[model samples]
Target: MGDLTFEDVTVRYGSRRRGVTAVDRVRLTVPAGAVVGLVGESGSGKSTLARAAVGLTPVTGGRILLGGRPLPRPGRAGPRPLQMVFQDPYSSLDPRMTVGESIAEAVARDVARGATARRAEVTRLLELVGLADERAERYPAELSGGQRQRVALARALAGRPEVIIADEITSALDVSIQGTVLNLVRDLRRRMRLSMLFISHNLAVVRYVSDIVAVMYLGRIVEYGPVDQVLGDPRHPYTRELLAAAPDLRAVGSDLAHVGSDVGDGTPTGSAIAVGADRVRIALADVEPADPHHPPSGCRFHPRCPIGPMVHPDREICRLTEPDPEPHQHRAACHFAATVETAPVTPARRSR
Candidate 1:
């Protein structure tokens, strides 16, 4: 199995006065040959987790393992089993190097190959990513956004990695172009049997590409499950909220339009957030101010919760005590998670 696993992973940055716990204790297992989508807003720690996976960021606590092997610490050479495709194609590529050369660099580093062999492999990669051999001679400045991204994909694949972490790889492309990249990734996954962690804020994209889905809030995963279970019948309030926000033909005439506004509120409710059929109970009122250095009191989510209206069995205690992640059919963190229901969604009004 090409599985990737994280056990109680936590990452904190800065000193007491200005520090932030970018990622809280998070545990996840991504099965081999599956595309798992990590969804969260800009500061929700999705990027942090992605960087940590490929050894770009340090793990303050916990461990990351690929195929049962622990990954090296940050700033060190990773196991060479994982590679990442960054969000911005424009910035990730070298303006000075041709697409062919960029791919060549990655291939050479991973595989001890001479110039001729690298060139041949680069040509094959270009074809695999749907780029023409002639396009390899072109520079990043000379290609379209989609083409540039394709080159980025080619470069990542050059390492022949078993696990690929694609962080917002298609966010910069037009909707039409995004589909092309998504299809390419889907194809590659099947052909190479590569396991991937596809991170994106766009639910539709996540649903389209993922075999399983993991939803993040603040710095922790709130809900995770098989794509069909999580996307088709989301159990957690947060998961329901995210699904409601996704644009879909089936969502017409529903109150889902207000999803954007609700999620942006940042209110921490004493409720459970799901993580792959497991539940984590957290009490908002009890959450201590996440340490100026560490911040591990009651519930980190209590500060901005809007669902206080819903009374739960452990509302009082949950409001005062820190809850831990409990294994459920799905995973979540919330003291009263079992009692919480999906909040009512209101559709956005169209201008007359």
Candidate 2:
């Protein structure tokens, strides 16, 4: 297995000149045998990046490499080296096919050419995901949400992939069911040494499973680094705000709490972060995100930034220049990133 690298990937939609750019010049990696978590808001383009990696979406620029080579085109295939498990299990699977048939269809020809072999493979895959062999005869509607998600994972594994992209796989499920699916993913990673790009809004879940974490805003990656360093010692204002907004962290007690404990064991003691954090209930919270087709000038985040312009008029560099992601232990795309660690956790000071 090799690293899955996205070098300056860009994805645009509709007319190139007038369309929206969903994913903008993203550079990320899912190292072999590691899980990289992608976290962001609703329109952050995490799903678009995942789709592009699997050829389900076209790239307008840059390259997606697997083991240092371009990913294979969709139809020109053997067993797919990369596979995606989509967010919605209900729509991802076909109602016409039984669970066995769905998993069997993705089975590599070499792995299961004959009918008996296919059945065995299906049974094995089912059991691999903690499902009973007999459940293969049931339709998708017959199973619960968690069970269906496991089936979706089982289908992705059927391709014998080197990497897996799980796009909000638990967002649609209840909390109880969500935990079971997360547990399965953690277990599978241990058993298979799977390389993954896990996308989600839940910071605690990401902390539990990811080795690396990449934070996105709008269509850009604003911060990224190892899980502990990135989450424990966030350098980006958006990352700090994101971490502070987490219910788990806020409830846990303080910011330093997550830094010491809450290292992905599922039982996070406290959630709200106190360091470099400023919860924007009335300020950044009310400001609408700018149009992706025509993002804000200079820094895309300046208008909502807690440390720029409205918050500190003297700090005008954020409005006059675009700061590239810094080269450091924890990278952040902010002109004042060097001072973020020292930035005080003030009350919401209305964003302009």
Per-candidate TM equals 0.80, 0.90
lDDT of 2 by residue, 130-206 (tens): 99999999999999999999999999999899999999998998866776787789889989999999999888778
**Which has the greatest TM-score?**
2
Q: After superposition, how far is residue 69 of candidate 2 from its true place, in Å?
A: 0.6
Note the residue pairs that clash in candidate 2: 208-264, 248-271, 249-271, 249-272, 250-271, 250-272, 252-270, 252-271, 255-273, 255-274
Candidate 1, residues 1-352, lDDT tens digits: the string is 5589998899888865688888888888889999999997668889999999888888889889887889755556533678899999989999999998898888845464688878889999999999889988999999999999999999988888888999999899886677678778877876888899999987766766678888887688878887666665555555554544444412221222222222121221112112222112233334333333454346555443323322343345545666665786565666656666544343222333
Cα miss at 285, model 1 (Å)?
19
Which stretches of candidate 2 lie above 4 Å from their native place?
A: 250-272, 279-286, 342-352
Worst 10 residues of 1 by lDDT: 263-272
CA lDDT of 337 in candidate 1? 64
Which residues of candidate 1, in runs, are more than 4 Å off?
73-79, 108-112, 249-297, 303-314, 342-352
